[model samples]
Target chain A: MARKRPEPVQIVKQRRDAALNGLVHGVPYVQFLGIEFDRRGDELTAVMPFDEKLIGNPMLPALHGGAIAGFLETTAVIGLAWSNLWEEIESGRFDTDELALGHLPRLPKTIDFSVDYLRSGLPRDSYARARVNRSGRRYASVHVEAWQDQRGKLFAQATGHFLMPASKDD
Target chain B: MNPEKLKMAEQFISAVPHCKTLNMKLTNIGDGTAEMSLPYDLRIVGDPETGVVHGGAVSSLMDTCCGAAAMSHPSSPAGTATIDLRIDYMRAATPGQTIVTRAECYHITRSVAFVRAVAMDDDVDRPVATATGAFTVEGK
Candidate 1:
């Protein structure tokens, strides 16, 4: 007699989905912004569907600068959510039910956000990614970049600090 | 006073998608400053536990206000875009309270306009957030 078990990769993917689904569905702002999530292996990306309501200027038809920053910050939260779920899994504390609640305790609180607009964000679909620069017990800092067409020609970039739960991973 | 110009700024801002989504409105524009208001809504809550308005909403309010202020500025006034912005959340806005933002285009150079803003709910003295930003100044 033999028993089948899920592979580590499968588990990670499942957790990522749980976190992403929880975030996209549970968070009111994220849903209000019409943001979606995608995971390529270990990297997390956020995609905001082009909606005219997001435009800041009617003539330029460009996205609101704050919307761009909001996408970056929300992406950072998504990145942190996945990482937090991963950490919980490692510590044998991961819970599927908790994901349904979309509780804020599991999410990071933004302390500050600084954004740089490199180019005008045209009225089109936009993408964003967050790179965790440093993570500590009390806080996590992330560097975020957003682009419309080419990653090199970033429309906007941001750096933010969030108050996160105490992590034992150091 | 350029009442016609301020009307244009308000109209332009009213068309912004995010502004519409947030129900943001241009309240006033004068000299170097512009003001906007965001009425309370449950859809903008950041945390259900705290029920505070999302910081993103506040950020959008400031960005829109700053852009309007830059355009409304008597000097170097024209179309403008955000160059950079830094915001510090002093505290969360009280739930069920409208958030008001006042931004001033304090300085202007050949290509950039410098602006600062404060966001508050009921207490003008106790601001919920403060922001400093630089914006692109296009041809008048």
Candidate 2:
């Protein structure tokens, strides 16, 4: 009777979830803003629930442009980090935990961000997805699109440039 | 500087929910320029290990300042919405220091107003970030 090995797919999936949870929860600003992430495989969609404190111009009753920008930038950093996670995990260079708490690696640093407001953000749950245009050893660029109701009809879009954290190997 | 416009600017900051959340205060608003401040708060910190204020908080301050500047401009309409904004972060803001932002609406056209802003903490010489933006103007 030999000991059986755990299923590879299930183990990988669990590790992936743990890594992402650590990354998102590590930042205090994300918790303060009440942002959550839905991860399907390697893709991540950021969700910012509506709160009265997010309103900027009460007359228009619109979500604050700064809040929206923060959401986009956060998404970009997470997306870039997630894209790099697999390589570290596959090479067995990164260790993860189910209860990682505050033990996350440093997140990518934002160098610059540009945002275009397409429409007033409605007072509801806002959703955003980030697309990594390029990720190198030292730098990454991500584009983020945010919407309240329909994904096709974006309320805002942003391009963010980030300086990737120095990897353990480097 | 018009006193009426100055009053409007004060009312504007007091009315904003996000401004209240950030504890933002309007210091000056006149001559197409606006100044505002956000007191250091632990909740808005980005990196817990470093205790540094988030870049988002800095940008939010700048955005609101830009809007106030645009509204106070002589050629501005009753309201303005952000069209596009570009922000460059030069360094991390020191913790426990209130960050201040100043914005100037330098140009206005039939449909748009352009603005530039800088955010700094105690170190006025080294800015935390700089921003340039375009805002929509309503009436002709």
Candidate 3:
């Protein structure tokens, strides 16, 4: 049987709301990244406002690459947490905080992630988005892109692989 | 030379439940600088096919280096949190190679400290990634 996918625009709206409502907890750093969930569904877009704290090179005044990577990883997690599958994981019926820790069971843990620097992220507000290439019982794959908001410059790109935990009760 | 700075760095990393698995070690410290290394392990691979180190692990290492560098400053003793970090991936590291990072404190102001670091497999020229960061010195 084919699974129904939520509209991209609708998913964006839901994620934005969840972010605003603090559906994802213990993330005081989210505001530091300047990332806001703007839209959601099959694809998710995040907006990061410029902040001096994120500068990597004072000489070039460019956004740091570590900050860019953090933004990308956080975006991917946010998208997954907003997906329909999260409901089942979060339901108290599981009775395990570890299970409710926002990690999807049946997925391989994110053993590794890599980001390639195509260009310097300018010292200005920027945007990032991610698309799920594949989601399975054992792993989920995602591709992400980040761009400067002013000139729309491409700053960095990343691919993430997350291991999904198998359903214990099943 | 204050032991508090190194102790703080050790405490912060140890506090992180996830980082406990990395078993990071603080090997050396000096003026405006600090060094730490993560022992190579199979679990740290980002690409098992290529044996490339995971970016997140690299970032965590970079973050710790910067944080320790900030703590080296005399004015701040309470410790600092990673305000932000930017890393550039240069290439994949060789498999089973201990990754060493050397972070230097460039500037320390009233509330923020600027840091830069390089992660190398064994050769400095052939760096796996380069990073710059800002850390917030807490407790004014």
Top candidate (TM-score): 2
Chain A TM-score, cand. 2: 0.90
Evaluated at residue A120, the lDDT of candidate 1 is 85
Task: Please state the error at residue A77 of candidate 1 in Å.
Answer: 2.2
Please, what are the lDDT tens digits per residue for candidate 3 over residues B32-140?
Answer: 7888898887655554445556565678678777777787766665656655566666777787888999999899888888899998987678988788777777783
Better of 2 and 3 by TM-score: 2
Candidate 2 lDDT over residue span B53-137, tens digit each = 8888888899999999988888886789999999999999999999999999999987899999999999999999999999999
The interface RMSD for candidate 1 is: 1.1
In candidate 3, which residue ranges exceed 4 Å CA deviation? A1-41, A44-71, A74-170, B1-12
Q: What are the per-residue Cα lDDT tens digits for candidate 1 across A86-152?
A: 6665444766577676553357878899999988889889999988888777888899889988878
DockQ of 3: 0.06
lDDT of each: 0.83, 0.89, 0.64
* Model 1 CA lDDT for position A71: 86
The ten-residue window of minimal lDDT in model 3 chain A covers A89-98
Docking class of 1: medium
Any idea what lDDT model 2 has? Answer: 0.89
Task: Tell the DockQ for candidate 2.
Answer: 0.85
